[model samples]
Target: MTAGSFLARLHGRTATGVPRWAVRVAYAISLTVLPSGLWRILSVDLRVPLMDAPTDGRPPPDWFGGEWWYVIGLSAVSETLAFLAVGLVCTWGEVWPRWIPWLRGRRVPILAAVIPAGVGATFNTLLWPYSMIMISLGRRVDGGGDLGLGTHGWQVFVFYASYWPLAAWGPLLGILTVHYYRRRKAAESVGVREDGARSPAVTVSH
Candidate 1:
């Protein structure tokens, strides 16, 4: 398939009647954490010194000592979680994929997808803003009061630019979850099964 065709299939509408915009948004959600994840890998694992080194004649933090495994693992897990948001707009979110043992091809319960995503959305929505607030107050949500970027304007700019996209992650996921819920609920209400077949309408004799 051509690239355009492949992309169309990837983001195409499924049985859920997801809008094209929503599919795009879901894809965007998967990318929201990428910058920060890459920043961590480059700064911590690769020791690219994105932040200023400590000036007190002390050695750098343990993370800067090439914590490749930890940094890579964290970034991997974060990106994987972000990618799960795509399921909200894909067929897999409504029906289990064929590879699963017993649940293969089974219709996924609505609550199964919504509850965790909803909870995650709520938590992330609160968490990032709270973190920014704490950072602004010169307090650290993760530990130290200082960000360790020192007084370099370029360093601060690059750091924030890499990390700022994270603030959109929660809101995007939340919106996508609501879209998933509405589409699925509408399908269920109209007796449309996961296969897109509608049940025969009932009639009452007068």
Candidate 2:
């Protein structure tokens, strides 16, 4: 009869750990830092060489054949995806949008959400290794005295070092992913057939 009882019986799962707000904040932090690193790459700025050549009087890197816009645009998009992950933790993923025409107040399916997000979060976690490879093999270079941070061997290590928050992206998402699947599957099984027999619903229309 109570709210807690209803949720427990309905969802068949316990909602625990990583408060919704904390997840949202985590996503926000990840989203911000990600863009900075991404802008450099998309601008082809990542390979600009962090320590500088020490010979030429060059002024950072402005040369990438004017295709710099691609970097700017894409970085924005990638970061947006990171931001989206935050919504899953909050109720927004379900029914918060009121500005949109058809999408406003619509329910998002758990499976529809979990698969892509679980995959993306896992992939994002892979950045640590990828970044390491890029740094060691001279791939993800940050470039110049303008970067404000040192570009030495130990300094170059910071690229991966600062990735703690990002690394948490997957496991945190994984917990939500599991919670969603359990809740959704429970919803499916609790439905009834029209023929007066008990049966699971084929499709959830939210």
Candidate 3:
């Protein structure tokens, strides 16, 4: 399906019945990462020196200013991963994609997605707050002093505004994950009850 149609299905416009807001939140998560990605891209592509020089007064690593590939690659990876959250509320999450030769159209075992996502959610949830706190304190969480972000006032504001959205990513992902789990469990329980009701009753012979 095209991306628009695929997104509609995830948003409860299709039969999946995932709440529209959940899909919106997933989309928001994707959007939230965009500004930061764009900023990084501009910094590297334009060679404008947007990021802070290191606090130690030593020259930054060669990769810092020279790595166009790193900037592009990192942005692509981050946004792509963020977009995956949309799958949680989509039908594709519960069924194998048609392109998969062996598992195509088969039911997805719920926990297969759940366990890894849950673990990731835990790490993600902890990450943003810590990072924000460190940023606010003007210290790198990795143990450095002020990054000397330079005197570009608007750039600093934009940088913080863009990056701050990331703080919501983990919490939103965790919420979506839980909602998916509960929805699948409820469906499974209904299926079990229906199956039980259809079974023939036992009878004893005298």
Q: Name the best candidate (by TM-score).
A: 1
- Report how far residue 69 has shifted in candidate 1, in Å: 0.4
lDDT of 1 by residue, 1-206 (tens): 89657865764344457777987788787777898889888877776867667889663465434557878888899889988888898788899988888999899999999998999888888888777666655667785767544425676677677766777888999998988898899998889988778888899999
Tens digits of per-residue lDDT for model 2, 121-159: 677657644544444555443422233332567535544
- Reference-based lDDT, residue 179, model 3: 85
For all predicted structures, in order, the TM-scores are 0.85, 0.54, 0.78
List the candidate 2 regions with Cα displacement exceeding 4 Å: 1-32, 35-54, 58-66, 126-128, 131-150, 153-158, 161-166, 183-206
Listed per model in order, the count of residue pairs whose N, CA or C atoms clash below 3 Å is: 0, 2, 0
* lDDT of predicted model 1: 0.79
TM-score of 3: 0.78
The Cα local distance difference test for each model comes to: 0.79, 0.53, 0.72
Runs of candidate 1 exceeding 4 Å displacement: 8-15, 56-59, 62-66, 142-144, 200-206
Candidate 2 or 3, higher lDDT? Answer: 3
